[model samples]
Target chain A: MTMPSTPRPGGRSARIQAAVHQAVRELQKEQERAELTVPAIANRADVTPSTIYRRWGDLAQLLADVAIEQLQPDQPPADTGSLQGDLRAWLIEYFEEMSSAPGRAMLRDVLGTPGHANAGKCDGFLRQQIEAINERALARQEVPIDPEKVIQIVVAPLLYRILFANDTPTTQAVEALFERLTMPTKT
Target chain B: MTMPSTPRPGGRSARIQAAVHQAVRELQKEQERAELTVPAIANRADVTPSTIYRRWGDLAQLLADVAIEQLQPDQPPADTGSLQGDLRAWLIEYFEEMSSAPGRAMLRDVLGTPGHANAGKCDGFLRQQIEAINERALARQEVPIDPEKVIQIVVAPLLYRILFANDTPTTQAVEALFERLTMPTKT
Candidate 1:
């Protein structure tokens, strides 16, 4: 079962994938992901079920593809010069995106879908985003922070609030997370 | 709607609630919460759907009640006497419970259910548990820590790993979380 990261650029295949993804999102807005059917998505996308089956193998794979595509940052991480500023900006952007309708829908699809090991796939995407920001921090000569530590301290709490508590992290909470991570401590 | 903190005292009502809660957990073990229907649950519990509706109003409320019941601690907090010891013991207990099949099932039911405001319900339950622990810490004369901060630092990270990352927090990681929370910090 192959999972295409993105649609092939400027071709018939690209158009098909785009339509399929759009159809999936629209269906998701109206119904639960588990209620989504391959034939229904194909009918909406104006493609054959066989085409979808051959491409994505099943609903889980198709939804994963759409979720990943939606989660990709619109642009590279902004250079905010300091590690604290950069981390704060990245996290706030992430929080805002995750609290939006599309982002929550994507998360619900990936997470709520049963029998799908989409969590590992989503974690990889999240780690890559953090690594990119860390690279920028390193470039600015800041002491490199542990990515795992960062995930536990910053990302995990925010995500817990988003997914489990269904609460949006306030700006103060976001800044507190950044401060707790970046502040120098007396061991 | 009156949400009983505990199942009503020994009587027909208690027996019914117990049977229904058991049926809910069994169904959750076999399938996702969203797929659970009132008829199926009623059949399993040997009660009529109207009975469930009368007591809980709907599937969401019934599931919420079951989830809350499963999450409530049976015993009072263990007093390890010291703040560090108490925190460590409490966290380890929580981690083990959350990593269990039943705990994960309850979480999936609360989180995976669409359009359910179960998050707030779960959060309140969690906060009550934390307060009970904090009360013990206060009795031992340790300065009371913020329950929300404890959640963000200790609980959220472990839960995020369990739910999203699918990675179990190691013993060292758990200890690190407790230490981070209890250690005196320079503000």
Candidate 2:
């Protein structure tokens, strides 16, 4: 059978999208504690297997899209008017989302998926959302650092802990990350 | 029917392992720009389907183990008598490896697979390896940074560019990352 096409529109399509996303979230919650599958999610969501495969291209892509949709738009980390303040605020928000149970679960799934590098469009959606905040930090010029690099510095450990070690991102870990990132070196 | 079990004898086991790894690698190369599957690999390797399924525990796990086996052992950064020097050297090596065509391609595949997180024990092996290096860096006081945070500082941009943004990790990116991590901030 042919796979369904992208989540395109009519009233029915939007409704399906909503249902699928909700199903994805619920499945993700289950995923946090156990395993998940399209058939299982379909049974729960009451959508057919053809409906999922046809619309989303694949299970991972669908979930990544749904997860991206769930991410809150990046905010201009508090205007503490300092790079450190901005970074702290930015990272706190970023990590809080990442460290949350759902976020952690989603990340674990994303990194665990094979052939993820080819999923560039989805990754771009997430990165751009992050980069916008980094750009804001750059405009402030309170800290003389590359905005992209700063974003990477702040977010990397949280992702690593969640995906690899299955550990929570602690405050001490965050603080240390911040300090080392900002310390001067022989640039 | 039960999956194929491991080879029965020592020499046979080694032969089986070598054949499996070779098959997996060749399959990866063949599917460099497309999707890969167990049947395709089995056909190419001239192995029975049961043998592949039994030994690798499915495609993702099999591939993850192959990738993990391919990773080089981490080397201590040259003791240039300074944390920055040592860290720079170490990270440069990391940056180089992660940016290499094969490295990026393989990683993308690892991240691309849906349900990749369930890949037996090899799912997070690479990240754990990176974490180990971070721990070593801390113990050696080579970077004088908190050990835990070091993983994020070094890896975030590398993976972000490779996995998310579709950019090859570059010397400039590594240098910029180094600067961000080394800059002084409000202690």
Candidate 3:
């Protein structure tokens, strides 16, 4: 959640981080997880084995880090003036990204890490984005929906379908839920 | 979903199946997945390695089978007369079972197996139980909710929390969903 030991914006550190992550992205395209070892990744990234070991611990951790990097939001949620507009745009984009093949693979990679620390981090990232949307709604003098409800009502089913790698809902389906959430109800 | 190669009824085949399944369960409790090889399992089950090799092909398939065996429903869904009664009873039991540590481990085991065929099987098992509940409602002349709706409203959130391996909801939260699903609505 707190960046998971990622190096901050800099010269050499940033360059190496990008190189190593890019190396993983390419190697994973050809090799299975078991075959993608530290030395191999180090060689591909043009770094020594000890550098990877000191930074990421093992392939499992590195894969988790790379997947997390792919999933992180590079910008804040778009402000659409109304909660309905804001949530619909945000969630539809999410549905598109996460329902894609690479997104699904990254999700599995994050979840497959030992102790599920990456899963927690992924969850944190989602929750933070939802919180931002809710804050915007509150500032706009509109009632904000509960972030927990968003997790249950929207994120849950969306992710369930993604994880199953089939039976994913149409964008319109998630849009309907977004409409339902922003509607005035007896909550 | 369709038993996936499980031997049916009583016979030597069933005996062998039970012995192997039990051996896998016992070994899994003590050892990590990487260490539970075919020879080790055969030795523990008092069977031949060739027997396991011929039957299950490899450790991944065997582990999937054992997890499936452990997850299969041994009985039909309970008929509580009303949809509310039936769904609440079923969902609460599922929430309890899947929230436990061993249950979570078993879920990860099934999902971890390559290809995610076992995930589909697990989904089918759950859907069957829900279908049974819905059929009972129809027979009783009560309105039945859609099974897909049940997947979205209940199973999705339930499995999402279970998969994350932490922050599972309280039993009351799931019971409340069961209540909501059975409530009269303008669907």
- Report the number of the highest-lDDT candidate: 3
Candidate 2 docking DockQ: 0.27
**Who is ahead in lDDT, 1 or 3?**
3
- In the order shown, the chain A TM-scores of the predictions are 0.79, 0.68, 0.82
Full-model lDDT for every candidate: 0.75, 0.60, 0.76
Ten contiguous residues with the weakest lDDT in model 3 chain A: A178-187
Instruction: Classify candidate 2 by CAPRI docking class.
Output: acceptable
lDDT of 1 by residue, A1-187 (tens): 6655555698888899889999998998888554689999999999999999999876756876788677766666677876667667888888888877667767765664443366667777777776777677677666656778778888888887887677777888788887777542222
Model 3 steric clash pairs: none
Better of 1 and 2 by DockQ: 1
lDDT of 2 at A165: 55
Model 1 CA lDDT for position A17? 89
- lDDT of prediction 1: 0.75
Best by TM-score: 3
Local error of candidate 3 at residue B89 (angstroms)? 1.0
Candidate 3 TM-score, C-alpha based: 0.81
Question: Which candidate, 1 or 3, would have the higher TM-score against the true structure?
Answer: 3
Q: Please report how far candidate 2 places residue B135 from its true position, in Å.
A: 15
RMSD of 3: 4.4
Per prediction, fnat is: 0.46, 0.42, 0.36
